[model samples]
Structures are given as structure tokens and as C-alpha cells.
Target: VNKEHGAWKCHRCGESGSFPELQRIFGDEPEAAQKEAAARWLVFSNALKVCQDTLLDYPHILKYLRHKRRLDADTIGKYRLGYMDEDFIKQMRAKGYNMNDLREAGLIAEEGNRPTFQGRVIVPYLNRDNIITLRGKKIGGNILQARGVSLGLFGADNVRTHEGDVYICEGEFDTMYLDQLGYPAAGVPGADTFKEEWATWFEGARRIFIVLDADEAGMKGAEKIQGILGNRARIVELPVPEEEDSTDVQEYFIRDGYSLEDFDRLIESYRGTRLFTVEDALVEREELKKAEGLRLGWKDFDHWIHPGILPGQVMVVLAKTGVGKTAWITQVLHNLSEYWIFMDGDHQTQGPGIPILMLSLEQTKAELVERMWRISRLWDPWMTDDHFKLAYRNLRLNDENRIPPEDVRVLIHEFVDDVQMMPKLMVLDYLGYWARSFKGRSRYEQVSDSIMELKALAKEFGVAVIVPHQVSRTGRRGERLELDFARDSGVVEETADFALSLWAPHSKEDRAGGDLGYMERADVRIEILKSRHGGLGRETRMLWAPASLALPAAGERGFKDLIVKEYEWLDRGLLYDDIHKRHRGGGV
Candidate 1:
């Protein structure tokens, strides 16, 4: 009998038993056998029994079991799920099963050799041959810890007959709940850890659904399991509530009272995909030899500038103090309203199409509104009511006033959801105020990450972002400013898809004398320092209307004229006129 005992222990419920008890649950096999099939069955039976009782009372437990234990309903029911009460413990003790043995079997909790699961739900696990081995117990109380004893085979006995579909959850109760809903499922003890043997059971199933608790840890576990299953698995994610951790599907079903249809819908809406190894993806990419062409949008400054402020692309407008960067961005916002109107009219009159979000970290809301009103009156004088809805948010003035990361997340989420088409353009008036760590920082590394995060936010929500930056003092005397003049030149250039530098040319007369005595006139130069798409680096002369704060036609050239001139440069290199004449059968 001692030889027959072998080295068998319940890994699922953390249980241990003597050779006789293992034999009674698994079956009397030869002592010399390499694999004790009976011991596996014994462990599986105990786990199944514990799952059924806990899940029947609290169906939400299914969410937990789906990812933890891998047992299905038919197996759960057949094993006769029950809870161990004081009377049951007394009977077991009468049969010579001491507290020490119960603790070892994980049938009871142990506090210095004392049992805790005196009255608790019982789940038994079985082997492939339908023999019971390990048992788990769900004890009631706010403070009592659950127990699991690993005998052999996680859900072996319950998995006697292979099914077309299998569900994987986090806990035993979750597996039982899924089984009750006419699905085959199993559970793991803990979400963070998984046994390698469980992978084999998933290999044979035609379809495998891994349902995890609606929490970060659960999702991570599901991802880990999906990594093991490869393309053979799909994930069924539970809808996480705003509060509380969702460790079990039964909690979602029973406590939240979600129906089977709702559950199915939730499964259909799972957002995660199986991750492939980098090496594997690289190999596949080489084998496919796929080449995707770029899709270019409008290259015109006016057309592209307003919209190209798109989510993934950052637009940095750098200017010296009092150079009108804020005014330029605000004018851009006003022009965007026209685009919104066009989109709204074309798409079923979506009601005042475009929305704009402005984060004026430097200015108060009242001050921003006043400036907006002054500009709005200039752009649309006939407007009696406020047509453009402006949103203003102020950043922290001091370190103590800084907004928490969670609050920022909430603000962004609310802003995105509240608007109809989401905001067409989001403007951050100044970069310095938006950063929490802006004090004593250069324009490069620290600030660059914050700007990149904002760009990510834009890309995530499909909105355009415009950020204003300050120019360095090094370029004040130069005739023309370059990208390097922008503070933290490297980072600003690297992060932005377009870098627009605004400068007001001072009269030579003012430089000749100590002061021009109010006779000097300044011309605003809009320099396209860097255009990631394509554009000449020439200054577009524009007259700034002080009253309107808008840029009207300066000289005889408009934005369109500048674009035509740039395009002419491209054609000059190609004698396109001769080619066109030949194609038309004309003299070259």
C-alpha cells in the first residue's frame, strides 16, 4: 500500500491525501504505474462539487470560474456539488479524517493546524476516467479565505467527453455558472498563474472562449492564456463596472443580473486579439511581401492646416511673446466652424456640425470667453447668439493645484462623449502650463513626452490638436527664424508634423535709431519652417487686422497664390507643358 501511494497531490485545490484515500477517489491501480489515472479523477471530482454549489447560489461566480477552473456544467452537476457544514465536518472527523488531513487536502482552512471551512460550498474535481481526486471549498464570511487542494487533473473527470466548444474562466464558481447556461467551461485557481497541463485540453476543442473577470488582472490572465492557445482561442471579456473588481462571471450575472443574451452580446464584443511573437510576425511579413501605398490628403496650407491637426500628427506653432500665436489658433478655430457646417449639412443636418475644445492653461475661462467673443464678432458679425461652443479648462498654477492623472482621464472621456461629432479641433494655448513638470525643464525630453501623450489622445479620439510653443531668444536679431530657434528645437521638430514660426518684421529705421518713435511699421511673416507633407519654406505676408484679430489678404497674394507658386516650382523641373503637347498631338 505504501508503494502504491506514489507522488500524487491536488494542484487545483491545494489538497493532499494518503494512498488509500487517493485510491478510493481515483481507483486501485498498480503501484508500478507511471501515471496514476485514478488519482487524477479523485482531484477533479472534488473541484467540480465545490464549483456547482457556489455558482448555483451566485451565478456571477461564472465569470471567475471561466478563467480559473476549466470544468463545464454537465461535469459539475454529475459530481453533486455541495457545501461542507459543521455536521459534515463532524462526520468526516468521526471517519478518522483529522483537521490536519483536511487542511492538507485543502478541504478546510488552516490557522496553525485549525480548520476554517467548517461550513462552506464544496467542489470536487475528477480525472479523464471520471474518478474524483481533488476538492475545493468556498467558505462564507467576509474574512475567510477560499481553499483548494491539488490531487490530480484540474477537471479531468468532467472532461471525459470532449466537446465542440469550451469556455475558460477565472474561478470554479464561474465555470459552474457557464455550465448552467449550456456552455462547457473550466476555472483556474488564481488568475495570475496557470498550469501548463491546461493548455492540452484546449487544443482539441473546435472553438475556445476565454471569459475573464472584467478587471485589468483578469484581462491580463486571459491574454496570457490566449498566448498559449495561439489562433485557436477567442476572448470573451466581461463588461467591467465603474466600481469593484470583477473576478468572476457569476458576480456579473448574479449580482449585476445580466441575462444569457446579454452575456452572449458581451462575448461578441470582446476587444482583444491574440498576440503573436515578434519573430513569428516578422517571418509572416516576409512571406507575404505586402506593400501598402500611402494615401495623401490635401497639400494646401488652409485646407490641410485646419484638418491635418489630426490626432496622430502634432502641429507646433512657435512664436515670440506678443506675436499672436493664440490669436492665430483662435482664427483657425473660427474657420473650422465653416468646415463643420459643411460636414453637418452633408451628413443629415447633424445640427451645428463642428465642436472645438480649448485648454487655456494660462488664461482664466472668463478671459478666454472674452477673447473668443471679440473674435467671433469679427468673423461672424451677424451672429447674435454664441454659435461656437467653447470649452475652457485651466491647468494647475502651482504644484499643489495640479490635476490628478485620473481626473484628467475623466475630463477627456467626458469631453469626448459629450460632444456630437467629438471636437473637430483641440487647442492647447501654451505647452508650459499643460505640463505638470514644466518648472525648470527644457523644451526637449520632458516636454516632448507630454506633447506626444496629447497627440496620442488626439489619435485615440480622431480629433485635431494644435499646440502653441514659445520661441527661443537666440533668433530675435535674425532676418528669418529657423526651426532651431524654437526652444528645445530637437524635440519640437521631432514631435510636430508641421512647425510654423510666426514673426513680425521690425523696420530698419527702428534698428538705425534707438527707437522708431511710433513711426515704424511691422509686417507679420508666416514662415512654414517644416512641412512634413510638402511645402516651400517661404514667408507668406499677411496683414493682421488688430480689431478683428484675423488674417485678411495681404498684398495681392493669398494662401492659394502661395500654393500655386509652390506647385509651379515642381512643374519647372519637369517640362510638363511639352509632355502635355505631345500627348495632345500638338507641336512641342
Candidate 2:
């Protein structure tokens, strides 16, 4: 027995059962309710076997199925479709099953013990070897399903083995037709019968085509499926109008004379031009509120750019050479790597801290490793009192040798796939540094292709990518930085979800002068040039601690307190000069 999953199998007899089932069989005698349920299930299975054989005896039932329902012999046999008539109750009694057992299995009425599915076609809902329930449908009439049984998604078991494209239709016949046409499909009992939790069944599917009935109820049901499955779902409307009846998938092909190719073309060409209602916007707003994404731990900056950097967003950090762009990015990376859990007393186990993958294209692997170590050293005082190890254990640095020049994007994808833990945040040292490696007609084309590739990777992997960009030589000498300053990349403003430029007020010449001993500790101004979430032209400052290359935000609560309250003796000279100077209001 597997204790974790509570499943056991007998090697000798080839018998397998759940732990609960084993307990009921051997551990203890079953209760009255359990015994009745077990008896009903056995009766139901026996009745299904008899009904299946009985189907062959009835010529009229077969004629109705073939001529009216358009179902062939093979389709009927594959689904185990059967027939039940007035003779059903007499057959059960001759087999030694009583009226009470038939009533318990929902095959007959409680009052007179009359067959409930008399003169109807039987459709059994099977879960592997056992039948979950049974439904009976009168030709061109209503459907009567088994009582007190959960009728889940039809053909739900088919998805466990199937992959790639899947179709979700409104009825079982529609699903069967699609399956016969070589498409993996499942069906709900009705147009609006799909449950939101069932979306997990299709998670492995490449795409889900929701071919619900083409009506108001069907359209609403399709939209609900799309919302639950996100962008992977596509609602395929039939060619017929909503006002008309029989506008389902089966009718579209059979009655409307549409071929498989025509149906394929219809789905492929469907652009879904349906306008969003106010309810859609409100639903999106609530989802955004729930997934506020990763933060940089700067309260002042986080306030202006609320909800942090969301998933699938590409944020570009830009600065001139020798400026503190990498330092700023390192600090953000360290902040994200630290364990952060919800503090509301509801979900306080751990925070949004996630694994990160760093591609050090601008510097060698050794240099990037040293940089991460130095930042952790400065920040470790706040994380722990341990002297030997660092706290940022989730950072993964890629080897520069294994990554090819032209196949940078492809290699990055492979790297992500090879890792055990997928990184939610990926850091690429700089874009322009590797953009020249990609083959293109011109430099501009290469840079643009590289930018698009990064954006695509972020979207495909659902990771927030941060890429630093170099400033043009001419733009470096300008008074202030702009979006166009990103060297060779004109699409950075348009492609990036957020674009930030970093520069210090003091010139490089000023840092060279002997008077500016505290030049390394200068406040580097970070300006948001573009933000898709709408915080454009906003500015924030980070105090650059040159000793450790840690860019802590100015006036932020934690970092400075950690430095002064705990690590003051460690960096006596630098801490006293920088922290005291800031406390005295001498610096910005």
C-alpha cells in the first residue's frame, strides 16, 4: 500500500483499490448506507450489461439511433449505448434481482416499481471499469439521469491520455462526433453546465476550442470558459444565427452542409470581435488585485508604481557605462530573492520571494557571482546573524560559455526547462551587449529582433524579465536621460512594460576630483521613462554604497536601519560618513 496516496494493488490477482475501499472490505463492516450504495452499484452494473445485449434484440431502437440520431453501429458499440423498455423489469426479476434493488439503483420508480427509463435509449457514464451513473433519453424528448449521482464532464477520462488541441462542446453527441473526426473533445450536459473547477482538466492542452451552441446562453457559457482558462481558450461560434434552434456543432456539419475544412477555416478565422461588458472589466480588476506581483521592497517607489512588476512584463533598466544600473538591478534582485510572505495573519507562511535566473551577458560568470556575494554580505545582517553563509539562495547564474551568440533566446528557454524550479524573475545583464550577436540585415533590425525575442520569452514563460540597456554616446553627454537614449533600440519604449533610466547629479569628472570622497555614496536618481501601468516620469532615489555595490532606496525604512542598528561596527568609517551625512539632511 502507498500510504501517501492511500492506493494498493494485489500482484497475484491484479486487483487494485483505494485505502477507503480496502477498509470497508476488510477492516470493518460497512454501515447501512454504505451497504445499500454498494448493492445499488452492483445492480446498476448488471442492468447495464443486460441492456447492452438487449439492444441487439430491438430493431426499432437501432433504426431510431441510425436514422434519427445519425449514429453508426461502431459509435454505438464504443459508447456502450443500450436500450431499455417495458421488458427491463421482467428481465431483472428473472435474474433474481428484486424490485427494491431496481428502485435503489434508480432504474425504477419508488411508488409502483415501474421502469423509469421504459422505451428509452440508455447512456452509461463510466469511470474506467465501473459505471458512475446512467442516463436515459427518449427519442426527440427529455433526458432522465440517475438520481443522487454526480454527472461530471462527459469524456473527462479521455483527456488523461490525449494532448495538444482539445474541443469542448455542449452535448455528448457533439463530443463524440468531434472525437470521430480525430479531435480530442469533452462535453458538458448542457450549454451552461461547465464548472469553473473543471478548467484544471484542460491545463495540459495546447489550446481549448469552446464550440458551445450559438445562442445567448451558449455565448455566455463560452465566455465563462474563456475567462477561466485565460488566453489559451478560443470560443468558436457556429455559422448559424442565435435566434435559430439546432445551431450546435452537429447541426452545423450535418444540416448546414459544412465540411471539416470549412469548420476548421471558421475556427481559424474567428477573431472574436465581441466587445467587453463592464462586468468583464470589474472581473479583471479583482484578479489584478489578487496577483499584485513582485516588489522591489521600496515603499516610496512601490507606492507610485503600485502592484509591483507583474508576471509576463519586461522591465528595461537603462544607464550610461560605469553608472549604477547593474547595482540598482542587483538590489532589486536581492529584494525579490529574500523570503517574503503575506503578513495579514491569513497567509503568513512565506512571502512572494521566488527563484531567479540571471544571464550575465555584460560580465563574466565570475564577476556576476562576486557582485551577488557582495550585495548579500551587506544585506545579510538584516537577514541573519550567521557569519559564514548568505541569505539569497534562490539566485541562479547561467554559464556564459554554454550560451551561443545567435541562439541566445533558444538557449535561455532550454536553461529554464532544465532547471527544477522555474524562475519567476529573469535578469539579463544588458540588451545591447548581446543584440549584436543575433543575425539580422542591419544593426537596427538585430536590436529590434532581440527586443521582440525578450518580450516573447517573458510572455511565453510568464516571467518578469529585467534587461539593462546602454545609453548612446551622444545621449550620455546630455543634461538628462530619455527613452531614445537606449543605444540601437528604438522599440524599447514600446516593447518594454517599464523603462527606467539611472544617472547621478554629480558628473564623472566630479567623482574623479579629490573633494568628492563620498562620490561612491552619491544618490543616483532613477526616473521612470515608461510604465504600461501608468507611472510615467516619476522619479525615485537610491543611495549607492560603493563598498558593497548595494543601492538602497533613499528614506526607505529597513536597509538604513539594518546598517545603523546592527552593522555600524562593521563599516565604521563609511557608515558614519554616509548615514550621518544623510541623517544631517546634507544629501538628497
Candidate 3:
């Protein structure tokens, strides 16, 4: 007996119970539930022992299995293979096991205990080291499985020992055979009997090899699972050419001459392949017509993203440590909270700003709020502490955010259904710092997948997403260079609509003689590494102000030197480029 309402579970058959309960735990009454005796697990354990003992009584049965099933002694012992005889019922009675308990536990025949598995081998289903259920395979009779126990996965316990790659088979023989060959393998009773929760067992598993029988039922079952598993799973249709060996993997291996190396070739073959062409994915003009964007407040930063950061586009921020990357984003969010635009000769749109959703994977919720509060104080000279708290309430911030690769799609879809309107700005701070399960993904794989998903999310909601990324130390040696600096990834530069690499003067020479303290004048230089819409290689210098959390010095410099406030181009309906060229020539 384990505990009240708690019993030992079968590993293979997945069945275990003690006796009938006159009453269950009722929602209205707790006293009676606590008083109920615990479920008895000893009954199933003794049944298994007795079954093994009874099977030992018939050594001929074991010999038959060794010859016919091609199973070695190790396999038989590992699986706790046994058999039942007619006298096993008397043995149970001698052991004092209640007949009613045996019936409920599915250890004996419901009507009579004339050895329900008479003249057959009994395969004990074990789970967590306890007998969960049993299966009777007769030498020449029909298969008889114990009632009440669900067919738990065979070799389900093996998943904990390995990670990344798993060979999933449909029956115990195939799974055991593959396991003996040094492959990490597991089995389900049938191809279609997979439980969705089983995915948790292979949490960090990257690739799943589905080794089922090569028939219609098997193929259909594999395809059905593919829908649940997505592209991470591949069905291995054993590449057996000979007609006699076309049925299963076990036969192909048992015949000899075939090694694990040859089997790898068949396992590597991909099933359920689907291909798409350009004609299936061409973006239509209607989508372009409805295109909208979010601005980065400052004219210099906004210019890098053109009219502004477009929906479905990604803007990556890469910087060395202490380079004000985070502070820059904080200032941007504060600006959005206050207004959509500013008319200080740089921004002329002028309106209440778009809403923001900041997924602060690196900072605490309070720390991010404090950062935002500091920026709001900089913008409003007379703002009080109460005002800061009120303003912080408007921005949506969640430090507790993560969707494991297994559940990412489903959970995201659930949120999409619940949300009435998506925010205009989404910030996933410091990508590498997120505390998410790898789900069989390497660090590089995790980053690439995240960047791609963020791109899709932005496009779907017409939001501008800013993701902070880390760069290599070499990329920030203070020497200007055009190289891929995104840590552990080319995907960062490839997927982003524009990449901004910020460098603060780590060298003492550049930081000297700066107005705002040495730390404030990071002597930050923002480079436009890759811009899809804007021209590349554009660079600007900026000064970091710690108190205000902004690029104040750089903003002033760019405003004075390059900002074109000439409204004449707009009045005459000429392109800004045309007017800018004429203005540079002193002829506008």
C-alpha cells in the first residue's frame, strides 16, 4: 500500500489498484477523504513475483522464447519476462492476497483464476520500478493483456538517460533490439498510441527517429505524429531492398551482415518531405499598401529604419558591456509613453505614442520600471515620484516570460486569441540572458529560432521589435570593421531589418575631456551594419547621459550637422533626396 488515493503504477501495462472504494474525496467534505486507507501496491508486486515463480515452473517456456523470439538472456531479465500456470491462483491464495484486490488490479481472471495467461509467457509492465501491468504472449494462442492497465510506453524509462537524439519504436522487440545495438531507443505499444505529454520525456531532444512497421497503419500513424511533433521528427522507413526482409527492422538486423552503420543510413532518410516554391510565397501589393510602422523617436535612429520600423521587421542592438544599449531603449520606451512624436525641428508627426510591451528577460520588473522612471523624470523637469508611478502603469512589462520550444507555438497562439490589440512596440531585452529551457536546441539554435520567431510576431501584429544581442569582443576593439559580430550567430545579422552596433570608448584616450563624467561619454558610435530598407555603412556618434538615460550629446550633434528642416521640399512636393542634394549645393 502506498497512500490514500495513491498507488504504485505499472511500468509497461500501466495498471495498478488495490480495492474498491465506497467513497471518494468529495469537494464538500475533506475529513472522510483523509481517513481513507491508502491504495495497496504490494498486491501487484506479489502478483509479479508469483507470476515469475510460476513461469520458472515451466523452464521449457523460457527455452522456447530464447529460440523462437531470438531474445537473449539479458533481454529477458531486463524486461522481467515470466509465465503463469494454473497453480498460480493457489499461490496467490497461500500468500494471502485478496481475490477481490487481484481482480481489481487485473492480475487474475475476473470470473475464475484458471491462470488467465495459462501456458504463455507473462511480460510484466514496469514503471518507476513497480509492476504497472502485464501482457501474456502465448506460444500458440491469442495475445491476452491485463485489463484496467493502460498500455504505457515500452522503454519509456530510457529517455532520462539520454538527450538530443532518440529512436522511437512501436514495439518492445524493436526498441530492445535497437537498445542492444547501442542506440538510445524507446517504444510505444502501437504507432498511434503516443501521448502528447510524452514529449516532456524528450525535453532537450532535437531529433526523433520514428521506427514503426512499414505498412499503411504504421505510415499513417507516423504521419499523424508528425503533425504533433512538427519538423523535428523524421519517420525512418527501413531501407530494406529484399522482399523477404521488407517488414521490420528487427528481421533486417537479426539476419547478420548488417551493422549499426548501415542502419544509420535508413534512419537518416527523411519521411513526409514537403517543399515550397516562390510562387507560393510572393508578397502581394495589398499587404504593401496597408503597411504601417513605429518610429524610434530620435530622427537619427528613425532614419536608419526609414519612414520607421516597419511591421514584421527586426532591429537588432549589439554592444559591448556598459555601452548604454539598454539605456538607449529605456529612453525610447519613455518617449513612446509620453507622446508619439516631438516637433523640436526633428520630429514633426506629433501625437500620443504607441503602446509598448517590454519582455525584460535580463532585468527585474522593478529595475526596468526604475529605468523608465528615470527617463520620464528627464523629459518632465517637474515630475514627482507619484507621477512616475502613474506613468509606469501604462507600459506593459513582464520579467516572467518564456515559452519552451515545445510549447512556443501553442502558447503564443493562445495569447493571440486573448489579446484584443497587440502593442505597437515589443522589446525582448538581452536575448542570451533569457532563462528558457533549451529543448534539445544548442545555444546557437535557440538564438536563431528566437530571432526568426520575433520577426514573425512583429509582422503579424504590425509591431516594431528591438532585441538586444551580444557581440564578439573582436567586433568592439574600437577599430571600425564590417564583420559578423553577433555572438554565436549569423542569424542575428541575417534576420534583422537593421543592425545597430554601439561602441563606447573603452580606451582611456577617447573618454578623456568629455563633459558628462567618463562613464556618461561612452563616446558611443552607432553603426548601421545591415539595413534592408536604408543604405548600409551609415554611422553616427553619440554621448550617453546616465541620469537621463539618453544619447543627448549625439542627438544635438546630428541635429545641428545633418537634420534637414527644409519644409520647401514638402511644399513643392519634391523628394527629400532631391531637396537635400540642392540644399547641400546651397541652391535650395
Best by TM-score: 3
Q: Sort all candidates by lDDT, best to worst.
A: 2, 3, 1
lDDT of 2 by residue, 213-320 (tens): 876677766766775687778878687744565498878877787998998888777644347999998996787678857777666677667778887889898888
lDDT of each: 0.53, 0.70, 0.62
| Superposition error at 3 for model 1 (Å) | 58
The residue pairs in collision within model 2 are 340-351, 341-350, 341-351
Cα error, candidate 1, residue 444 (Å):
3.9
Q: What lDDT is reached at residue 409 by model 2?
A: 38
The RMSD of every model to the true structure, in order and in angstroms, is 17.3, 18.5, 17.3
- Worst lDDT run of 10 residues, candidate 2, spans 340-349
Tens-place lDDT per residue, model 1, 478-539, is: 36667787766776677777788877676344423435322122246677777655554855
- Model 3, position 195, has a per-residue lDDT of 67
